[model samples]
Target: MDNQKDKILVVDDETSIRRILETRLSMIGYEVVSASDGEEALNIFRKEYPSLIILDIMMPKLDGYGVCQELRKESDVPIIMLTALGDVSDRITGLELGADDYIIKPFSPKELEARIRSVLRRVDKISINSSIPSSGIINIGFLKVDTNKKQVYKNNERVRLTGMEFSLLELLVSKAGEAFSRASILQEVWGYTPERHVDTRVVDVHISRLRAKLEEDPGNPDLILTARGIGYLFQKIMTSN
Candidate 1:
């Protein structure tokens, strides 16, 4: 029986928000560490190495986007951004910067907890699957996907991808040539059910991100293709002898 608690890093400028989250999350069996600004967040992240991060967008000295971008450069630890209400652009920016999820301000602790669990669950699933002995390497064009290692390489060079990005890619590559609807992708990749009605833009942004990293030409992607009316698919790469 593993009794180890998941550690979460909460980054916010507000003392109230940090305190509230720390208290509530601790009560729910998570080990919570917090920072009042982005730089502090990075420092704490380096030392604490939390399993997940709850990052606030607005902060003194480096903001959430900066921290997210910096973190993405070296770590794939899950990140959940806390954005201001009605800030669609902010949410999109956070997602583009490799945040796994976003929650608007004034959100209930219960809702945040649910989002945290969902994101962590996805990460855990990937970790467990990667640990399986049957997992093997997948070759698509110049790309190499190692399911056991949960890593991607392009033209023999490693491509840095966030955990969510890798999960999405793994799903598509696992069933190449299958068109997955955006809603279906949300359900399968993000672990959101149909009734959850999650914004499909999350799917689009992640697809775009993957293309930018894996495709020779993101403007005309050869690997990840749009299915016209349905959604998207990973093109089946044909090898010539």
Candidate 2:
């Protein structure tokens, strides 16, 4: 069981919810640290540097958004936001603030655990394969992608990207000019199956975030283009070094 220990930080104002998550996650081989609010969560985060964070959007003494913004300034640790609001804007806001994933409140424990597992798997997979390249250095005009380093540089300056963001970009660039539907992207990037009733907007949110980080003019992206009634496709590399 020593090998199964991955510390998880659970941040929520609700005691019952935190207790429930702590118990359930602990049972499944994770070491859980519970925080009642965003401030406390941030304190614990700096100290523990947990493997994953389960954050609540609505919390006293600094909301999840603020904590996320603060954390993004230094860390790219995976964050799964818990929100009571079902509005698409709220979900997008969380993603824009660097949350890896979001789940609506009143969700089942199993579903939350599944999301945690999916996110951790993606993070771990990226770290393990950082040295391997699916394709060599791809040059996209002013942007350069060093797949071997799992890095992207814009005008020679490194562009910061989260694990999932890089994964999404890599997937698109891997099959340049090939339109990948939202459902396909969700399956490939998020490990969500077609049988699962997952929101396709997740793909759109991630794509929008990628554009913001990687494109000089996110308003009119040139690298990743929308296929209009379909999905998105990356332009093929015109040069490679």
The clash numbers for all candidates, in the given order, read 0, 0
The list of candidate 1 runs beyond 4 A from truth reads: 1-3, 126-135, 194-198, 238-241
Q: What is the C-alpha lDDT of each candidate?
A: 0.85, 0.85
Instruction: Give every collision pair in model 2.
Output: none
TM-score of 2: 0.90
Query: Can you write out model 2's per-residue Cα lDDT over 59-173, one digit (the tens) per residue?
Result: 9999999999999998988899999986778877988889888888899899899888888777666433332344668788988887667789999999888878888887887
TM-score of each: 0.90, 0.90
Task: State the lDDT at 145 in candidate 1.
Answer: 86
Give me the runs in candidate 2 sitting further than 4 Å from their true place. Answer: 1-5, 126-136, 194-198
Q: What is the lDDT of residue 15 in candidate 2?
A: 94
* Superposition error at 209 for model 2 (Å): 1.4
